[model samples]
Target: MLSQVIRYDGSMTSPSESAPLDGDELETWSALATVLEWLPPVLDVQLQDGWNLTHFEFGVLYALATAEGRSLPMSTLAGFANSTLSRLSRAVVRLEKRDWVRRSTDPEDRRVTIAWLTDSGAEVVASAAPAHADLVRRLVFDSLSAEQAMTLREISRSIAAAISDEGGWRPGR
Candidate 1:
């Protein structure tokens, strides 16, 4: 007769004897988990402390700044920011209030609205860009030698491609 016991940590201590995952698979899983845990906070801290922006806000501004005519359709901006339309709209409202952005209907297409980066927005982004790049280098690239950085980039791209193929992934989706 077997009796089941629950552990205090909410995990089962007694094993049913499942097969173990391969070492590479385990490493991949662990690395992904660690990245998920670390990436968001790092972004949040750098944006908030360094730039007075949230990650999403920075993304929206960055997209518009780099876009043609410093503008983009709201739908495209949403995709670029990896955000829902509603969320992007709200952020746009906040940016407008700050005089950092403007919204207007596209002259050629009344159904489409365009987000434009204002002079203030451009100034803010320009000021923040160096700090943001420095943070990225410190957090990611600076620790690696040039060859290692190149190798890591290749490995990351390959992994990204494989994951995209397996999961039907979309950039910013």
Candidate 2:
């Protein structure tokens, strides 16, 4: 069923067209697909259990924490987080409710909004980072040989580059 150039009814497909995987290709794809399905939820569970943060919320905070002046424009943050503005805004509202983050109109551009991390937010990230990092190491790094880690980084980046410009929802405000 996972073939090209041959349909289930025994008709032929275009030879130049891509077909579904079979044999070793299918096995490799299945393994990669499993990892893709499993990793995010596992990470979310860890963050939610340990820090009361979803993986996405943590990613947003972590991005702000590393940004200069602990602030980034909301739109830019949304891009960096690979999130829709609506989702980022909702998360910002939650973060604001916690007093961990605050928003301000950009001084140079009134139309632009900036998300600023409060001292409390910085402190929270500082407290949470070690545990999160330890979990990452235990789950990912500790299991890989140095070569495999390098290969993984390379393969992942390559795959990302291959699809980075492909079609996807590009939500705007």
* Highest-scoring model, TM-score: 2
- Residues 96-150 of candidate 2: C-alpha lDDT, one tens digit per residue: 9888899999999999999999999888789888988998898889999999999
- The whole-model lDDT of each prediction reads 0.84, 0.86
| Decoy 1 TM-score against native | 0.78
Query: Model 2 compared with the native: what TM-score?
Result: 0.86
User: Could you estimate the TM-score for every candidate?
Assistant: 0.78, 0.86
Worst 10 residues of 1 by lDDT: 1-10
Q: Write the per-residue lDDT of candidate 1 for residues 1-173, one digit (tens) a residue.
A: 43443443344544454546679989987986897799778887888997678878988999999999999999999888767788899999989998999999999999999999999999989988888889889877888899999998898899768865655434334
lDDT of 1 at 5: 39
Off by over 4 Å in 1: 1-22, 167-173
Candidate 2 deviant stretches above 4 angstroms: 1-16, 168-173
